[model samples]
Target: MTEPTTHRTEVVVVGGGQAGLATSWHLVRDGVDHVVLEAHTLGHEWADTRWDNFTLVTPNWHCRLPGYEYDGPDPDGFMTRDEVVAWLAGYAPTFGPPVREHTRVTSLTERAEGGFRVEATGPDGPEVWEAGSVVVATGGYHVPIVPSWAPALDPSITQLHSADYRNAAQLPEGGVLVVGSGQSGAQIAEDLHLEGRTVHLALGDAPRVARFHRGRDCMTWLAEMGLYDTGVAQYPGGLAAREKTNHYVTGRDGGRDIDLRAFAAEGMRLYGMLEGGAGTELTFLPTLTAALDGADDVYRSICRDIDRYIDAQGIEAPPAAPYTAVWEPDTDPTSLDLAAAGISTVVWAIGYRPDYRWVGAGVFDGTGRPTHSRGVTALPGLYFLGLPWLHTWGSGRFLGIAADAEHVTGVITGRKGGARTEPAADLARRRSPGEIASDVALAG
Candidate 1:
């Protein structure tokens, strides 16, 4: 075969999502030459993967991508998947980087000459790039993780992962059992229930938080209290925190609050964590009360922070109403037979695990998790970004990616020993008149 098309760059940033784009912004600002290799068009996940009416769990104000922040009228509101995708698509051209869309990196090998050799396939066919450094900015949630017990279920019952689920009409005619009570699972269960389909949600230990507490957005209080600043080491759960699911909250109902108990109140069934399946029968752990208790604890924890913030800021605001509804699980029907309940569909929203198979070995741990200090991998010149809890709890989120990217860039450039510096001028140019006002709020 003919030799692969060869090219070279100072740095090769892989994946074109928010993480990669944020990294590119820092690199470009520092005057580094690089190429962004994307498997598909920019923000394809937000465009194609999410359902039609899917709204973000986080509000629009949290949509801070390095130089850009949400400046729409509803800054406190949540953005739909399409709106986010459109914004990202438009944001890509702002910096004018050399981005090669539709280029999928199939393999990444270290070169003896002290760099990386990236092999990818693009529209022009096989291509190769030699770079001094590589940044894998692929955000989390690449693969849908179905439990080991999934295959044991009877094949007659249809199954789909949350990634594949689009709308209620797509599923078969029957009750829907949605596994995992995280944000996605809870929202989907609510959607199905609203569509007149019977929905059953597998209870998880995800915490609950109100959309607005005490006349202030919950996120604002959390951010001010440095909640997102919590790192993996400092996390109360330690390693377990890395795998913990997000709180059960939704942006639907005009940005109103939603939680697992709210779903139960809306006439959906709630069950404990799925244990296993025997033919058409499914067994669940009897931890429903524990899950509800855990959520209550989280809510209380947040409320405590809100109370503290109010005291510190000296701003008079209405006290939040005490949240009292709790789901009382029925002790009788723990195990349910799918056929008997008329449940023909199962949606697995358990979570996701990253696949670094294409990258060289030894950079990841025995469990295939990357061992990195903030985004710096063990291997020199190989880095990681956008991983959950990589540097902090918000590292994987849009609002936090910029700081992480800036830190990684400092390490790469040896500037101020990996410390972050505010790029006010760069950010100001990217903001609209409306966005400038929001940016001011972000600074405060």
Candidate 2:
């Protein structure tokens, strides 16, 4: 085996997706010397893993990269999977930092004196990196999570996660029972249903929002209403929005509602949460009505906000419509038989959990979540970014990552007040002529 290569830097950023690249941008702006390590190519998940018909749940306006906003012709529209991939890839060259692609970090061991020692395997071979600071930007969606009893599924039924699902042609000829009623589950169910497949969607307590209201998108109104400004630490009405399920909406069909109730109205069978399965029998909880009620509550709350925004701004906009989609009680078996229902596949669209096994002990909580405050961990020089509620309601989103990154860079560089104060000479040294041109060419 070849000897491990070693490099040193002021900061080492793990993962080269939106979060990592965003962090790198601020670091470059501050003239901090750092390198980005990506397990695959930049935006690997978006470029290679997403389904063929996959589009963003958020619109193009929310697809902002650090220091760059979307200025394309369709600012009000949504970006397809390919557009998202290209957007992220195009972001990196603007800063022109050295991104070590195809490099997978195996371990992050904190040095006794200070800083961290990052070990990885790259194209050539094993490599070692020592850095003053380490930013774990691998993102929250690291691993796929299925129920504990997923292995007990029928031998013949094919199992896959939403991350692995591509299209209807990839599965066997039969109905599909999709578990989890989050955005992914609802969208996948819709995709399968649109392809003429009988789909049974297991419902959870997910909220629904109208695709658009009045003359603007729901998200735009939310931003105007200051809903996106609500941080997890102090949400309005003491609501723990972090624990709440993502609102059920879709970017498909130029932004549309894709709630479970709507799916039920379209002939797709709706079931409760997937409790467990033995052999070919799957058990569901009696939570169908409760889930619908929860969605209705969220929908009403959003309409209330829209009404308040209209009155507050004194804008002459049309009245918002009420949510009318209602769930029909199904007579289907609570405990379903796969053979009887002709379900030859199960798609688990449940959310992901973080795994810090590679990270040295003492940085994570009992629940495997990293212990941090606005990306700053207890250990000095160790930080985290891209978590669902790391700082705010939009923490994991593309639009919110830059603020978190700026905060973390502030923590790293000790610039805690007043103006940025970054010297003009530092910027001139870091950004080349082409990079300067590219940065200026982006949306201001």
Candidate 3:
């Protein structure tokens, strides 16, 4: 959809990803006049930002984008990168959202007169749009975080953030040193390893989980257990859990546990947290064993939770088997010469930094995190949606966005002068049958 030079909308949502589109769907259904402004094409994050071999860690069934729930042939299977892109692209037209792609929001400020003033450069140069309320649905995982010490590495060795890493072929032919073992880092390491490349993994304390246990997807068990529905305020981590690194797992091929120990057993080099070094020398902490142990604890903790849930529900599932550590490190190497190790590339899978700087100053605290109660900000008429832990563990994921979108929309509808819906806290509080009342997104 095209926007005029000067335009007005009842609501303006900034972003065109699943989160933004989900909010747009709710607004459309409620008969709210709104426009969605996107910096890139819809689904560009899945298409461009992700690696070539990427598949969602979550199963296809969770790809519930408001009206567009996954009805694909294999709901339990993971969608390939192309499949995901197509699915997301197909979602917009189903509800006919007023989305202006490639229009980056440069600034958003609350107008003293009332409402909001949004400035952006679209296809037709600078454009100004006014709206009564604004929703920032640009989900977390924004800017790729590379350390300031990164420049100290040798010049010949290629450096790529996990965002820029498409495939092993993109890097020079040699061993690859992958730093950070979060979801992206672990998956990328596996991708490179599967391609028959020499992979050196720099481990962080990111937890790992099995894809399937007791003949069901872990997600399946968790969903039924209602772990995904955990609210931010109710979470043990409170809001800080939003900053926690996701567990390392995979839906690659069919889906399986990413056993870094297994990788080590297969002769892949493993190191501790990278501590940085100049020239070709790279130093590491002796955290590999501890990181590995910590990850195992989380894995076993999930198994225990599922076992307890099954027993409590009186469900006739198979007996749970304990996870035995496949391998253990004798001594973690503290340093390696990149040239000596034949590592020609370094993939920084550290993670992304949230960037809400374009939004007004009052929306954030000193730390720059947007402070709100389930997307409703302190300042009237402004909201946040699709942020990690905004409402629940599923809040930002495909598993939870539809309900969150609806809840945020409900809040907007009921704000002061307008009356279209009631307060939406209950929408988030809705529970599934037999779901553990105390179960959190976190297993422990």
Candidate topping lDDT:
3
lDDT of 3 by residue, 1-444 (tens): 665488999999999888899889888887999999999988688888889999899878777777677877766678989999888889988989999998999899888899999999998888999999999988877889998999988899899999999998788899999999999999999999999999999998898887777756677778777778768777786888877778888988777789999999998899999998889998999998999999999999998888888889887665566778889999988999999989899999998878888886487877677888888898888888878888877878887888778778888887333322221223222334332222221122
Q: Which RMSD does model 1 reach against the true structure?
A: 4.2
Per residue, candidate 2 scores C-alpha lDDT tens digits across 166-254 of 99999999999988888888889889999999999888777887767765666766765555555677885543555677888888867
lDDT of each: 0.80, 0.80, 0.83
- RMSD values for the candidates in order, in angstroms, are 4.2, 6.8, 5.1
After superposition, candidate 2 runs with Cα above 4 Å error: 236-240, 330-333, 416-444
lDDT of 1 by residue, 260-309 (tens): 67678778888888888867999888888788878888887888878877
Alpha carbon deviation, residue 438, candidate 3 (Å)? 29
Over 4 Å off, model 1: 237-240, 417-444
Deviation from native of the Cα of residue 315 in model 2, angstroms: 1.9
TM-score of 1: 0.91
Candidate 3: where is the Cα deviation over 4 Å?
1-4, 415-444
Worst 10-residue lDDT window, candidate 3: 435-444
